[model samples]
Target: MAEENFETGDAGASQTFPQQCSSLRKNGYVCMKNRACKIVEMSTSKTGKHGHAKVHLVGIDLFSGKKHEDICPSTHNMLVPHVKRKDYLLVEIENDGSLSLMEDDGHLKTDLNCPNNELGKEIKDRYENGEVLTLTVMTAMDEEQVVGYKLDNK
Candidate 1:
């Protein structure tokens, strides 16, 4: 069998191999239905005679908060997606609630949605108070989202 290779970073040092459904744990990242999600729960069971053990998984989309579930044989392999978190400085908040962020390397991201959560509210408050805030951007499966934020005291 040809070994499947997975890249974990730009350095090409870290790698991940295919994981069995039965081996996945809650909070672990997995690729299901062509989307990257974080495992929320896992269950396993064996039915009547001649039935193979199956694993049931409940996952939430890492970026979108959407729920997904799947059932597979315990021996089935699942892809584990690579997730990256980046920090960006909040540059502006448009009138429509969209955000503008600047990366440390000077890249600008505009028209990004401010997440609708407590952290999002906090970031907005800080921005309204004229405080500089830095945001945590999460990327997975070619999707990007603002997941967290912190004040930039400098």
Candidate 2:
């Protein structure tokens, strides 16, 4: 793994571009598009005049990881890789908070159990909402992550 580098923005220095990375992992979402981007360090600098804060994101290369000062947004939209959305059902939520989802193929399997303590609140909410039993599936555009939804609607 490459170490995160920190630096100040100097006019003469080289720069890197900002890469759109996943904020969610197993939760849901996919790397629809990917590009090499170098991480740039940013900090708040105050001028004598009061003004709104501004954000500066720098982009860099995938291999060398050299920092650049000037960059333009990617001209092309990123393509998210995905397929058709599938449906599933919620069979049970264990005391452990792990969730089991039933597939259209008649298979009941664990999808994701949040955590034991965290599940009590959700279980109760689901029970009250008439969603005690349900199904869910990953959206086609974001298959990397799973989305829990009602199975009855299907």
Expressed as tens digits, the lDDT of each residue in 1-154 for candidate 1 is 9975665336653323488888889999888787889999998998647676888999998877899999888888988887889898999998788998997889798957888888788888989999988899988766888888887788
Q: Which stretches of candidate 1 lie over 4 Å from their true place?
A: 1-17, 46-48
Segments of candidate 2 deviating more than 4 angstroms: 1-77, 115-124, 128-132, 139-146, 151-154
lDDT of 2 by residue, 30-123 (tens): 2222433334443333432544333233444322335433322223222233333465566666776676777777877775653334334665
lDDT of each: 0.84, 0.42
Worst lDDT window (10 residues) for model 2? 23-32
Leading candidate by TM-score: 1
Pairs with backbone N, CA or C atoms under 3 Å apart (clashes), candidate 1:
none
Q: Residue 135 deviation, candidate 2, in Å?
A: 2.9
